[model samples]
Target chain A: MAIFRTCPDTGLKIHSQAEALIKANAVVGIVFLAIGGLFGIAVALTRWPAVHLLDPEWFYLVLTAHGVGVLLFWIIFFEMAILYFASAILLNSRLAVPKIAWGAFALMLAGAILTNIAIFQGDSSVMFTSYVPMKASPNFYLGLILFAVGALIGCFVFFATLVIAKNDKTYEGSVPLVTFGAITAAIIAVFTIASGAIILIPTWLWSLGFISYIDPLMYKIIWWGMGHSSQQINVSAQVAVWYAIAAMVLGAKPLSEKVSRSAFLLYILFLQLASAHHLLVEPGLSSEWKIFNTSYAMYLAVLGSMIHGFSVPGAIEAAQRRRGFTRGVFEWLRKAPWGNPAFSSLFISLVLFGFLGGITGVIMGTEQINLIMHNTLYVPGHFHGTVVAGTTLAFMGITYLVVPLIFRREIWMPRLARWQPYLFGLGAGGISLFMMGAGTLGVPRRHWDITFSDAPLSVDVPGTAFLMMGLNGVFAILAGLGGLAFIINIVGSVLIGKRRDKTVARTNPVVFDGGAAVAGYGAEGTMKVPGTVVLVATFFTAFVLYYYVNWKFLSEVWPLS
Target chain B: MAIHPPADRLWWKEPLATSEVIWIAVAFLWGLVMFFTMIYWHFAGEQNLSSEAYKISPEKFAERTEAMAAKYKVREEGDTGVPVVRPPAGTDIYMFGRLWEWWPVLELEKDKTYRLHLSSLDWQHGFSLQPTNINLQIHPGYEMVVTLKPNKTGEFSVVCNEFCGVGHHTMVGRIYVVDAK
Candidate 1:
């Protein structure tokens, strides 16, 4: 028999085992974030050119650690927490196997520790891609393999929990939209982990000298199958959090369930094909293959993102209109919970992700245009837009809500919480923009010195390139402070914040109507999202102008056939 | 609510509002436009990457690069003693990328096409030609052939953008493009 505790705030039954697991995964994830974030700051400072903090050896080593720690360990561990919450808590059902979940966490922890050890051991500094011939220690590959296996098992546990919910009839009708979104993430995780296993196991053996050689080209092709798909998993989970926050804060519903769900289905079909984007400038690939895969089968997956872009804010606008904030088209948006960190962060994530991440990603992924941008600072610039500004910020946003709801503790510093997202968002946004600017001016990525101070042949990088790096350094510090604030706030709240009492009002109640249909299709019985329509139009115009501008830039480069 | 299951058993059949329909249509059409634009570029665009590549042993590739360098040697660049080779227009010119440098700088003529053969001797490296900003991936055991026609006349720098150990930042090569006359 599973023990349960009813949350006084949300009035939902939470399984004790599942709650413990969620807390464990989330806390571990934050610990990795802290560790990796330190390394990240070091990287930014070193890249600043003015600072040039680390020596070449330490720079490469820290870069590897930062990538593995944050990208793989931190994100996945938090995703594990999300999987558990979406299944057990949302369905009001018990976790399928509590013991197995603990085992998975232990394995992941062991893997992360092992990988860090290998990185610090001083010979395994072959960056995250770990491209072949340039081998890291056997332990590095082994650690990643272990972590992938653990995550794969965790995905299975989530699936089993969903089955348990169905059989137990914990809730009526289909699983909640949040749970459905989580299901998409879990599905992608499984595919990604499997790809990791296929490529990594052999690489581990190769490192041990059991195998003579691993072809570099083949390694890249398969490695990105795991690497790029992993980021896709983040996209799915982040979008899910967006929906959850909107509903919790403002009682928002999807503008159309069919539209949103179909978009997610499009992800399942087309998103993984984007692994081709990395290989576009590589040798031995045909233009036809490159065109098809890089575009995600005619950019249908992009269509998926575009659809969500409209529906999410559209849902919010419609919800606000229903509450009688209907003086004008802008009234609904102006009256929104701008002070709420969760709401503010979600909005920041939406705009930055679409305008910066989404737009640049499509431009660089273009087969011909990639020639100008490949392996430049532009690549990192683009991902910072997606992963850091978009996914990481959104994850930070949700934590504010998670602290009070799941931990049953008041937020430690409410004032700090309100300002945290903007500080981080603005800082990260600047970093992305400046890095891209430097890249367009022909500054390379992963190089220790742009000035070529120590090289036989020198590069005459524009003075503006130095300015971009200087600005990146500044924004990095701001983002670092923002991250520190979040850590302090969460750690303080979890440890000593006042416990929630029955008398205290629920500011954002967890509302579920037992899957009962509500009357009215849109706000005020007629669909009206003039504000959202205008916002999306602005986004579309920016995207079009940016897309053509890149092609124009491509045209100016040296002619090639 | 997003945290709850659909209120209706048939949420799939729920009708979309006019705005939702219009937005989806516009976004889908945009996707189609971007998709076709790539295919269109192959026909009209001059900056597209060539798909010509071959498998060759590292030793064989190194041998070919040294032979070409010796045949077309003009003058050594600076105090480094690396040869600067000015291969004739429309010739098959070779540039080798390795642990620490792009060997034997090549000089080409403006507005003339040449087959530029690129390969790595040891680890994988990036063929990042700056100023003009053309980039490609270089892998050992494979040779990539790019059809290059330099429109501008000046010296261009090739910076290895891919991380290839401690000396990666130092891995730079040069190409001099002169007037066709």
Candidate 2:
């Protein structure tokens, strides 16, 4: 009753239902990526001040669309594809409920369309948070509810697929390391979707006047459980992809299977607590809640990331060393496949995410330090590092392999693919850094203009802040171009590229060991990861310096008498 | 190659490498340091806005703000058209955020603490004190109390960082901190 075709390239048994679902989700994800990305570039140009592309009305509307389309629709759609691939294809088992999967996809598609239409219709310009008392149409809340339910259903299917794999005895022992990471993401998605439903259903009724009032403070607290934790899901899935790419490209296993898996388990327990960072400045919440969530417990989640941060590249280093690149500390790193876009993007993502996203996140998460950076341009700057450079970039890196393996098509622009990561990474990384720099000098996020020329009381922005926005604008344009290149490459490959079969020699294809289950633990000789240790040390030094600098900045502010 | 399940091994039961143990321990120690730092900052240092907050009616908040303005009326000319209200040192000051403006532009003394109470009349707004860059969300029904002690003696700009509506960018307030007597 089940038909599985072996992918000639990756050599993994892909279920027919899974191949269709992955393709559909990926294609839809790309479509929204284009829609949202176009709005994103416009937003950048507008924020540039020199350009100031759209007026306030259109700016807010496009921003709302951009947030929903890219942040929610595009990323989640791609994540769904990932869920299906990780469970059904990686486990080499049939999807548990193919019909239910299709229904879920349909609901998601309907929801995405309805929300975009509501936003574009220009009444519901409430930004992504959509904080309460600022009302939107009934359609807006309804659309979101539908989408959350659909995603919830998809999460259930992912769980069901794992169950089918277990019952059918698809694998000999434990699920693969990558599959384990996906499981973490799925669990987080369950929590996120449930949180969304709890708040959104009531909000929907309120829009219809079925309910009188929804408390603003209560809305914010519940919304972030869905909003911020959704990104945590991305973090988990991207880390999983990091492991998968390393294994597929270089025959690498995790440095320590137990350690890596424990890190993921930590995500399940503590990552959602990080959502409390958004409510730190809210008047309703007490300091006890804030301190507990942001510093004490949330630190465990940070530790999880630090663990993966070391283990991923460590695995890569050990694998490279085993292949005889073992000269100096960084010989293995330097001798890596820099020519491969997959490797370069993954490496770039890891570095930018750790240095920029991770460091800034820890700084902002600090209760006292958050005072200086809350609601500033620094907020978006921090997230761009995580979601764009970290998750989106990682996803882009893996797509190179996905095209060859799933779509059975060679990349159309091989030359362009090589430079895509650097262009995007440098541009996006600059956008993030410059925005944070401007925010430090006191530029507010969500403000159409920092100048406030027409305002009753004008703000005095230092000259450097303006310069930062100008540079941010230029880099945003560059990032837009880089995103364009990625879109063109992926779309062209999926649409018109030549197909490959068993006759064609696959380059860097994932070679599976015949019927011999490989435990994730490397042998003692393969555990020579001095280069990775050095890199992790460098990361920590940078993190400490940055964290120290922010505290010093906070200290310089007005003292309480 | 015939597809095979992974080796029959419980990978989670395996021992961690030396590097894994060392890094996890170090990271955990760093976390503990951060946790302790938060405690120190809250109790020992003049950092963090851990002040008392309570719920208030928007109408009552508006009335109290008006009464305060009348109580400490200042004739000094202010920026734009908004009037300046200089409340004396160590007093409870009310600043209400309405559709597009912060009421009773309060002038405070330098190096003296004032319990500044902020609430919104219509929608949620951001109490973003710029230059200093201390921001807090001002919800309509809730009073956010911040202990403000301005070290510098100059007019500080108040920018609403939260997106309220179409005129969100132009919503600005002022807090003039004069030299201490």
Candidate 3:
């Protein structure tokens, strides 16, 4: 028999083994985030032109570390925690093969450590893509391959836990919407890891001198099959976090389960195809393949995200209305839990993601527009909007609740928690905007010096580019402080914050009723969400305008065929 | 709640709200519009990437690049010792990218088209033409042919945007577009 502890606040059955694993993964993930974030500050400062912190060698080295640490290690580790929570904890079932889960974690930790060591040792400074022919140390590829395998094993364990949940009849009907989203992420992860193994293993051998040569074009095509698909995994998990937070904080139910599930289904089917966006400007690929793949087979995956953008906030509006906050279109929003860090972070993430990330992504992914945007600072700017502002912020929001509910502790420095999201969001938002602005002036992405001051041939970059970089530096510092606040609050609460005992009254108990009683479909029959409709309309307008503006920019460039 | 199973067994059968129905229809149509736009641009727009490319060894590409440079050598781009070749309009112009530089500056006649051949000798590099902002990826062993027509005459800078090596920042080339007299 597996030991289970009943959560005092939510009254859900938490399997002890699953809880420990979740805590362990999350703690390790945070450590990587801190390390990666420090590297990020150095990168931002170096790119600032005026600040110009690191030398050329150290700049590239730290940039590579930053990418691997944050993009790969930190995100994946937290996602591993999310996989466990979605499977075992959400289903109220014991984890399957707990011992194997521990082994997976250990392998992942070892891989991450090895990769970091290889990177810091000063030979393997290849950017995250590691686009070979520019070979790094053998340990670099080995570390990544091992990390990918460990993550692959973790995915299988998640699947096994889902099977156990079904067999034990832990819940009724289909799994929850959030778990369904996790299933989408896990499926994508399996495909992504397979792609990594197929490519990276051979690249690893070539690094070891076992193979003679690797085709650069072939490497890129297959590498993106892993690289870009991993980001799609982030998108899936982030959306799931959005839904989970809405439900927990507002007691919000999905506006329509069918619509949301179908969206997740769309993600599983077509999201990986967006990897072609990276290859839009590459040689040898036909325009037909580029158009088909970059658009996700007619933008079906984009359609999925559009559906989610509406449904998440729509659900929130409906719930707020039910609580008698229904005076005007804006009342429900105005009366929302602005003081609560969880709600505030989710709202900020939703807005910045739609405006900055989603809009820029579609514009840049356009076949012709890619000519202007590919390999430019614009690429990084666009992703920071999505991964950092969109995904990372959502994860931080959930941590506020995760601490109180899972760790059973009161939030330490509640005041700082309230302001952290805004600080981070504003800073990240600025970084994305300024970087894109500089890129518009033709600033390169991975170049240590945009000014080209020491080059054999010098080119004059406009003064506006310098201003943008300086502003980006300022935002990086602000974002650093915000990140520090999050770390301190989370760590302090976990270590020595007040523990919730039976005597402590649960002011805002997380309402988990095991989904008993038939909740009404479609917001109590004639659903009225004027606020959500208006909000989505504005988003659509911004997207449309931005798309055309990029086309206009493309038109001004030198003519090509 | 999102964390719990649906209250109804047949949740899939539930009806969507009027707003959601309208939004989905709008979104789907917009997706179609975005998809067709790329295809439309190929036909209607002047700036589309050509599908013309060939597979060539690094040695062969280097020989071709140097041959074209020696034949059309007009001047040397001051002390750098790199050749400045002024290939005739409507001819094949070759520019090679290698370890740390974009070889042999090319001068072109404004408003005239040239079959520009781009290839890398060793690693992958990005062909980023600054000020005008046109970019393409250059990979070793594959020669990409771009149809280029310079509409405006200026001293354009060709910067290697792709991270080739530690010296990537120093890998800058020149392209001068003179008046078609």
lDDT of each: 0.89, 0.85, 0.90
i-RMS for every candidate (Å) is 1.9, 3.0, 1.4
**Candidate 1 chain A, poorest ten consecutive residues by summed lDDT:** A516-525
Model 3: which docking level applies? Answer: medium
Q: Candidate 1 lDDT, tens digit per residue, A284-388?
A: 799999999999998999999999999899988988877788888799999998989889999999999999899999999999999999999999899989988
Clashing pairs in 1: none
Q: How many clashing pairs does model 3 include?
A: 1
* TM-score for each model: 0.98, 0.97, 0.98
CAPRI verdict on model 1? medium
Residue pairs with clashing backbones, model 3: A561-B50
Alpha carbon deviation, residue A90, candidate 3 (Å): 1.0
Cα RMSD of predicted structure 3: 1.6
Docking level for model 2? medium
The candidates score, on chain A by TM-score, as follows 0.97, 0.97, 0.98
What is the overall TM-score of model 1 with all chains considered together? 0.98
How accurately is candidate 2 docked according to DockQ? 0.55
Query: What is the C-alpha lDDT profile of model 1 across B80-102, one tens digit per residue?
Result: 99999999999999998998999
Model 1 stretches astray by more than 4 angstroms? A505-526
- The model with the greatest DockQ is 3
